[model samples]
Target: MDKIDKQILAILQEDASTPVAEIAEKVNLSSTPCWRRIQKLEEDGVILRRVALLDADKLNVGVTVFVSIKTNQHNANWYSQFSNTVKLIPEVVEFYRMSGNIDYLLRVVVPNIAAYDAVYQKLTQSNALFDVNASFAMEQIKHTTALPLDYAGLN
Candidate 1:
């Protein structure tokens, strides 16, 4: 939460696998203190988890589709069922309940239109939706997992 902690976070965000010694050097601290800070960050839930970023194109699931859904069913049972159904679908990488014209939104990744069609069919069959609209993303202009740290305002 201090300047040194923020610096450590910036370094870890850039590369989670960065050696403790290197990070310590960059942050102008000895290895032990820097490591302790990192450990504290993890224990405090600031560092949730470290993961490897995969190449979707190489994995044969590069195509992205944004699905907007509208549902008339507003009961808890219906919401629970629908949320569970969506969570079980592997193609649905991101799902959210929105407060707008659209009831829900999902970002689905698939290899081709046929695969997306299958996902669409599964969704429609599993839930009673008033409307479902999907738009294929032609390009990914900006995509990043790194979060903005300036908003924290502790640096």
Candidate 2:
């Protein structure tokens, strides 16, 4: 909420495992206040979860593809069915409903193009996918899991 809180958040974003004493030192606060602030931030739902980021390549998930999907029907029942089915698919890491030509966009991770093709076929064959188009990510120029910090003015 204040400058210190913001600074703490920034440091935690970089590394959630950062020690309380280190954070306090960085933010010019004592250990107890810093720990309390972190606890309060969690209770307030400002800090969601602390997780370790993994290397996709090392995990045998080297390829990332974005899939644009359009459904035959836009009804509530249809959406419910579609969302439920998509959520169960392991290859689909991210799915988004958008205000564009496509009804949904999905970010899929796989080991190879063949694996992606198989997943794609399985997904479309089982779902009400009217249209599907995929674009592979050639290079990840700037990929950050962190949210933008300029949301102070946002409502």
lDDT agreement of model 1 with the native: 0.95
Instruction: For residues 1-155, write the lDDT of model 1, one tens digit per residue.
Output: 78888899999999999999999999999999999999999999999999999999999999999999999999999999999999999999999999989999999999999999999999999889999999999999999888887666454
Q: Cα lDDT of all candidates, in order?
A: 0.95, 0.89
lDDT of 2 by residue, 35-101 (tens): 9999998999999999998899999997999999988788998888888888988989999999979
Error of 1 at 43 (Å): 1.1
TM-score of each: 0.95, 0.94
Q: Name the candidate that leads on lDDT.
A: 1
* Runs of candidate 1 exceeding 4 Å displacement: 153-155
Worst 10 residues of 2 by lDDT: 145-154
Candidate 2: what lDDT?
Answer: 0.89
RMSD of each: 1.5, 1.3
Pairs with steric clashes in candidate 1:
none
Shift in Å, residue 5, candidate 2: 1.3
